[model samples]
Target: MIYRMLAINIDGTLLQSNGKLHKSTKEAIDYVQQKGIYVTLVTSRSFPSAKKLAKALKIDTKLITHRGAYIANEIGRPTHSSRIKEHITYDLVRLLEGFPCQIRLVHEQFSLANKYKLNHKLLSKTVFTTGDPIVYSQQFVDSIGDTIADEPAHPLSIEVYFEYKEDLKDVQEAIGKMYHEVECIALNDLRLDIVPTGVSKLTGLLYLAERLGIKRNQIVCIGDEMDDIEMIQACGLGVAMGNAPFEVKRAADWITRSQNLHGVAYVVKEHFRKQPQIEFLQKLNIIK
Candidate 1:
């Protein structure tokens, strides 16, 4: 099928396990954009963190970040934001107080977390997508619920990270039964991302598709995590990285090489090369 837009996840999809974007991945992205296909970074990372990678790749398109809670263009201006209601955010924070997990509230401009969690390794890992410090500000608080109540805004999502999957599972179940307005996504064994009920990479992309005037069927999405499952299921051409979990791979239409092997390059080169535009260039003795 002909595709007009490409949405790619950053972690484990574009960026390698070591948290670096490979040269091959950059070249592949450049080729796709040159072919006139809109390529966007769809990631679970904060906007600033994701923006850094997009800039590195020379991708000027808007990014779908925070697991689709926020959608913004290359300029870092949000086009759409789906946030948990203020009361719901407060309620979740309250419920989470009984647990030992680190709580962080993600906003468009900055992030606020419990001051006590600043040095926690799991929380630190959850804070920044890369080793480089983010341009955005990070504030620590005594109580996330108090912080949100005092300074109410559209928080992108609330991340609760635990020391083990069992803790995360318990919290997920509690949130599931307690609230119908929010959804709990176990990003891994230790982190659970709580966002609005319907928010996912697919919903975020749909909003972007509307803004770009592209049809849903014209979009191709690639990702590697459980948070990516919905978009993989919805996109016209869904690709899973070789390193992706079994379930994510099962949901994909195709599975490419692993991140370390430059899977993104493999997918883009294999698929976009077959497009009429690229084929014409090949037939004309231009690009090999």
Candidate 2:
């Protein structure tokens, strides 16, 4: 089938190891755009963080962010936002009481705990692909204190990250028992994202689809992680990168090459090329 729109995840899928968009990938996107296909990016990163990437791709379509809790256009304007209920946030804060881990409260960017110590290395590593860690750190310090606090007035989203998966699961289970109002998703072995219920990449994509007057089956989703699973499965076509987790691969409709190996470009070419053949066959009334 020829899809009218394509939604691709940024990290771990479209970006290379050096955190740069491959020249081939950019060209492929331009090629598809010239052919009249719409390309959009769906990511967990905040608007500020996603801006530069959106600019690079010349995307003016809506962006899915905060793990689907928020959806906005290329200009960082919000189309929709889902916040965890006040009571749920209160419960979550209590649930994390005394837990030995780092928690980031995400509004648009990351807000760390007031007393939180700087893990300079980890911070640098995390933002290395996105932006300057030192600059981000300064912003965090300037906005919210070093230690994260439970401010009912704020009513923001939260991401709990642990150094170990075992601990993260334990915390996940602990919070899961108390509140059915939130969603807990593991992005990787090291990160767990907790957001309001019904908030996911799928939700964000659906919102965009509605705005664009496109049906679910007319969209293609691509990603390389478990968090992308919902979106990939929901789309008419789901593409998993070779480096994606086993579960993600299994959930996808098709598997592509590894991210570092031009996997995105390869799959895009395949999809675009098939369109012409289908059109040609339709013209001949062959199998129509």
Using all chains and alpha carbons, the TM-scores for the candidates as numbered come to: 0.86, 0.81
lDDT of 1 by residue, 1-288 (tens): 678889999888888988888899999999898887889988877788888888899988888888788888643467888888878888888888777777888876677778555345655665455213557777777887777778774577887777656778898998899999888887677878888888888888889888877787788888998878888988899899999999999999999999999999999889998786645655787544
lDDT of 1 at 171: 89
Tens-place lDDT digits, model 2, residues 94-119: 56645655556666544444334435
RMSD of 1: 4.3
**Position 26, candidate 1: lDDT:** 90
Which candidate wins on TM-score? 1
Q: Which stretch of 10 consecutive residues in model 1 shows the poorest summed lDDT?
A: 125-134
* Colliding residue pairs in candidate 1: 62-73
What's the CA error at residue 101 for candidate 1, in Å?
A: 1.8
